[model samples]
Target chain A: MKRSVLPTIAHRLAILCYIAFALFPLFWLLKVSVTPNDLLYSEGVRLWPSRTTWDHYAFVLQHSAFPTFFKNSVIVAASTAVVVTICASLSGYALSRFSFRAKYLIVALMLLTQMFPLVMLVAPIFKILSPLGLTNSLTGLVIVYTAFNVPFATFLMQSFFDGIPKDLEEAAMIDGATKFIAFRQIILPLTLPGIAATLGFVFTAAWSELLFALMLINGNSAATFPVGLLTFVSKFSVDFGQMMAAGVMALIPAALFFLLIQRYLVQGLTAGAVKG
Target chain B: MRKPWLKRLAHASEPWLYSAPSLILIIAVMLVPLVVGISYAFRDIQLLNPFSGGFIGIEHFRDLAKDAAFYTALKNTLWWTGASVILQFFFGLFLALLLDKPFWGRGLVQALVFLPWAVPSFLAGLNWAWLFNPVIGPIPHWLFALGLMDQPGNILSDPRHAMWGPIVANVWWGIPFFAITLLAALQAIPRDLYEAASIDGANWFQRFRSITLPFLAPTIAITVLLRTVWISNFADLIVVMTGGGPADRTQIVASYIFTQAFKRLDFGYASAIALVLLVLLLVYSMLIILLRQTLLNKD
Candidate 1:
């Protein structure tokens, strides 16, 4: 029952290779962003530059619309995540603890929302929102993103809720607390990890949403990071260094949230997989 | 005795009360727009033209049926979706299996490998686009060094191979999704079965072939189905990278619909194209479900 030395070496090496492949592009992105303008074309494609500077980062941070874009993206993504999690927690709670006639229909409807090309909704959504003064507003983006994320977050939260024993809530119910109070007091506290995971997931999802932002919002004032970066890219097609610097900045929050919550994500996912 | 009927009504209404807020939002945002979007497929609904909301039946469909770009896009959609899903799934499965084994620094490695999934799709596209560029990027030079191309050139602008650029970006960005899910499924697998199999002298490959694959099958099925639908409808990468350019070679149905709506400002035509794509996807999903049903029945 002894494992071979060569096989273990191979396994370790393979994992390292996968990690390298996953990280190399991002590495190159960071690499190019710091290389000076002079060395950029001359020492082009070098793994590392002989000389590096923070000029691009400085310019992006100090003299660009990136701060505004960052603000807008934060507003849109955070608001969407918060709103979606609230709705999903309620819906997920309902699905987990209740017996209702429309349960199957509700599930099916949520699934149906997942299926269609959201691009189809573009025109109609724009049409519907234009009159309400919602178009070109962050609120509109939040509303659209909340609806899109609620279904998946509900499913995710439902799995986490399912993992908690029913007796935890039932016991609370029998102790004379209302179901709402029991859920708020007993259940929500236990699902903090799941809630964190959902918030992180929805934040990243909403952060990366580009098409709707592009379709619905316009002008520089309200542009999210994606739209802002896109416009920045097209506007300064020659300035690769600055653009990559901005890209690096955009990666910060989502990556931090992801690194923190990924363990919980896998945990929640395993719970769901077990149920399946 | 208490009124049991009133209590029963309260019990029945409670869950709905909990669920009502989400249901209301979905109906307003998703459901209503969906119906309006479907109706837009038949009616003229130009964004610019205030006079364009007239009902025109099947005209957009008829135009779409005849358009040659739509046909090319259909073909590209198949190739794009098929290659992306297949590559993402296999690599994801391999990575999941690799990580499932105990190793030192596994926690760090797991975080590193999954980092790409956190990168915004637009940034992923832009990052790869820069990578494929001849100036200030390493990928083309690497390809040149390997003699894969005559010169360090941008494949993103090459009509023959532009599709691969975005496909590669997509595969990289999407791999962790499958990996994370598959790894969860792998972990969900009870370890005792493997221990029992090994006690009977089964090798690793045999144990995996018989036990791991079967355990992973259901998760694999559902994840793959969901991913296929999701990726087929995903247009961000293509839209950002190629803009569905190099003469529409990379234009999938989703991006094509986006272009029709966003650029042309033709909501009616875009909705029509979206409707057709929706119908096709529904049929594909039904077929998969039925196929699984038959396979299950046979089992």
Candidate 2:
């Protein structure tokens, strides 16, 4: 049915308000990132900068340790995303398709894993890892992030697997293909959207993870972007321009990653919303 | 018959093989750590000498029972979860309803509203920190200019308002997830039901009450449950904003656990607090599941 004009206008207005509220911080981030350092204090709450400069960006990139942090963040997030997706895909398919004897128990246990606060597990995890010489390293962060992220990602992938018809894989299996072959050849290709979604989800999660990185990595050498941002805050004065610039810069990889995977993200969101 | 029996056996065995890799990984990575965490809760194991502790039994639990910080953290956690989840869900549903109607620019508007979820939580927190800063932050400046606040440092630095500052930031970040999920549910309602209601002379409110609310109940409950769990466990925003200070006023259980473990180096005591947190979450989950089952059975 066609909506009336009045309600349509109201709906548009409401949505516009919501959009403005959501995007205001991001717009502010960009606004402050380019505002000249002198204008930052004196602009007196202006929406747009009177004069714009790339000094903050240049300083963060060339003068600060942000470049190193950005590289480390990319390496850690990409590695964690790749590793978790691989592990979650294998496991998610099993959870979706199988009915083994301990399947219920395993599923319950996995759900249980998600229940406890990550902070609660930090000490024990540190204890476990510190003995293995895993602390204060990028590899440790990746491993920890991968371990923490896998359960949720597996559940995400499992739902996607459930959405796909099993008949396609069964048909492949019936044609004399081994189960792994069917999974690799037929099922995996269909689950690309799910894989992409999982990758994007896990990548951003690891990319922005701060608590573990703060606790586990003590020095500037192995810091992720979040920890690196803290360096902008010294004992006395906070550098607003530099911090905002770094914050804006940090958005780039995540934005690019999402841009690449948005097609799948949209598909994944709408997947089970309605019957075909 | 022999061939068919062999095929049945293979089918039965295949699931085990398929599930083994994940099960093993979960057990090694998650289950073992959990078990170790529980045991460590009963000890006085300091980080400096983790293995040097004897089983102190219920002493840690007893100590926690008397600790004022534990109580404060527990109270703050309840407030954070209750307020954040309820507000996020209400605003999310409101926005979802507004967007449910077809209008120009709906797609672009939806994309913009959902952008917060795309942004990293850390960055979101940092952005809000800047926004709430007393001197340089625009929010206090605007509030002062508008005469809403007598001075600049009222919101961010005050013990009373610091928690709410982070809560607002979190609600900003969380609203999009709820909106998207609830919007999906709203769109899934059969159009024919509304048509039937209108045909029966029901007005918009009546139709929404009779149809939309009931249908959306399950999705709403699940969403709230998920959000409750997530918001309760949320420590990052608080860590970034206040670090559980001016006087440990904003310390939730997660941040409390973090402080105990990392800052104090009292791993055993932290483990105890962690166990308390685990038990609390277990009870909450069980309660939600039971409620869900009851609701489902009624349906």
Which one is best on TM-score?
1
How much is the lDDT of residue B237 in candidate 1?
92
Q: How many angstroms is residue A273 displaced in model 1 relative to the true structure, after the best TM-score fit?
A: 15
* lDDT for each candidate structure: 0.87, 0.79
**What docking tier does model 2 reach?**
acceptable
User: Mind giving the per-residue lDDT tens digits that candidate 1 earns over A8-108?
Assistant: 88988888888888999999889988999989889887899999999999999898889999999999999999999999999999998887789978987
DockQ metric, candidate 2? 0.46
Per-residue lDDT tens digits of candidate 1, residues B1-299? 36898898888899998888889999999999999889999999888999999999999999998999999999999999999999999999999999888676666677889889889998999888888989867888889999999998999999999999999999999998888767756765677899999999999899999999877776677678778988889988998889999999999999999898888889999999999888888888777767756766765
Writing each residue's lDDT as its tens digit, candidate 2 over A1-276 gives 456777766776777788888988899999999998788877846779889999989988888888889999999999999988988888888888887787767666776877787766666677778988888899989888887888777876776676577888889888999878988887787666678767877888898888789778888788998888876766214677888898888888877676666545455444533333
* TM-score of decoy 2: 0.86
Query: Residue B239's C-alpha lDDT in candidate 1?
Result: 88
The best candidate by DockQ is: 1
lDDT of 1: 0.87
